[model samples]
Target: MEYYEVLENFGQLALACVLGGMIGYERQSRRKSAGLRTNILVCLGSCLIMMMSYEIYKQVEGMTNADPARLGAQVVSGIGFLGAGAIMKEGVSVTGLTTAACLWVVACVGLAVGAGFYIEAIMTTILVVIVVGVLSHFELKKSTRAGVLQLTVYSDNNPEQLSIITSCLDDLHIDITKIKMREEYARNEREQTIILVMEMMLLNSRHYSTTHIVNILQDLPGIHGIELR
Candidate 1:
């Protein structure tokens, strides 16, 4: 009701908008599904709800039953719906987890601002920006160094090809995690086939070329066919 109090409330809302906008800007730059306006609305809505909670508390200040934080607390769990909307699942890869997290944290930042926890809100905003902008690329580069390798080799049931394959991987310092082998036979064809499903950790080193590995495997005696997936 008071002019100063109105200014204070608007200030919190403005801070929430600015902080949420920063997060949304980063996601927008990355072309994410939940960007800009979505995040700003989420933060602004949360801040408004928090301010309403405080107002309700003031109205019931003389009553012993008043709990200012009761309404604001719901915002924490209620934000999950928005967070879930930002997430996506695709086969083996799940994307948009970070975007979902950003939404959740921005909501928290908004609540903090509305509740007059300015320091916490500002620090959280800075950290969110750093995580979204800087650490994301670092994690991506690290992920490129690790993967699974599925290899199927056709040989004359001889162990030589297997030996060369293991030797090549060992020399290249590649880590072998798990391997499964199964034998397949064609009724119309005379030669039997050995199918190898190997899970390997690939290093992003110059010496490790998949093409070179395939060529070396092909050169082995009695190797009828080679496939890598």
Candidate 2:
């Protein structure tokens, strides 16, 4: 390798490291999973891979059969698995989607820096820090008002009570997406105790707490029992 080429490659590696550190620091300060060391290693690894590819390209006068975008594109697709691993679903609530997205962005930043797109990498890193570290709190605050409610009702004597209950829920402006009964058993009888389960998607879901709903149903004419899960 020529002396100047070696120096230029070293400069690319150094700058990639420094920029990665800057972004990682911001995320680490917030105690994110993909913090300093993780980002640093990613940046270093991408730099090495690109440097190798650049050398191969140089050998062919920048006319190699191998594509420059090959490795970078793979990095993006592979990073999706990491992002999916980060996201978690728990009983009508999902978490870590944004964190997972941040991790993906980190990989992109590393690739950009490795490919000598310093300005774009640095700008994207700053935006990512702001998006993940700064904006997350507000998004969380906004989401505090969001919640999900599940309900099941049993009635024995009054068959018409089903309409009443549904109407009441409608009056409350609650959105009901699905209503199913006899899903657990083969029998459907009007005189027999019937189960009514409501699957609802709600926003600003604080208006009716599950406990509060239970309390309200206690005195209703035909209510047998209520379950929330």
Candidate 3:
């Protein structure tokens, strides 16, 4: 427990906090739930645990039972629970996976700092920031290939059917951009029919075809015909 040793350990903790905060800053700027304070605390706590493990190893010198890396191994696997907390499922769309992953990596960065792997820790922080910041736009652009789907539906004027259709669209992760409804009088049946035109943004359009959506809507009661434009 020399003064220099204490300084070194303190410096490592500081580095871990800084690196973790940088990653969290990116997430915070994007309005993510787990941001600055959360990341910093996780990193600092991990670093402290690792530092204690290292000190224990030094104290138990010449002992065959000591393992300096044992605590760090636990940190690696134990971080999963924290990461899982960051994930959220909304309808068919899942969010916060990237944030969870970032937290996991930040934990690793903290361990690296505690182990005196400064270079590796710094490099990993930079890479995480680049992936989270720069690559996200490209990923969004790539998924927009399917773009928007425009559809017109002919059905009976039933509010229940309309509710079912909207619910199905939400489950499909389809965002309704615009919707227009007009009433039509059927000459043969004397019943009122509804004509609905909708513009929707498909989240996973590659997996869902126009025909697939039409088939799904056809199953709902009161839907007579569906036309994809």
For residues 1-229, could you state the per-residue lDDT of candidate 1 as single tens digits?
A: 7999889988999999998899999999999998999889888988988889998998889898889888878998999987898787642235688898898898888888888998999899999999889997886676565544456666665545456666777776664443444455644267544543323334434455677766776786666677775
Give the least accurate 10-residue stretch of model 3, judged by summed lDDT: 193-202
Candidate 1, lDDT over the whole model: 0.76
For every model shown, the clashing-pair count is 0, 0, 0
Residue pairs clashing, model 1: none
Q: How do these models rank on lDDT, best leading? A: 3, 1, 2
In candidate 2, stretches whose alpha carbon ends up further than 4 angstroms from where it belongs are 62-64, 140-229
Candidate RMSDs in order: 7.2, 7.2, 8.2
> Measured by TM-score, how close is model 2 to the native structure?
0.61
TM per candidate comes to 0.68, 0.61, 0.68
Which 10 consecutive positions of candidate 1 have the poorest summed lDDT?
195-204
How far does residue 161 in candidate 1 sit from its true spot (Å)? 21
Best by lDDT: 3
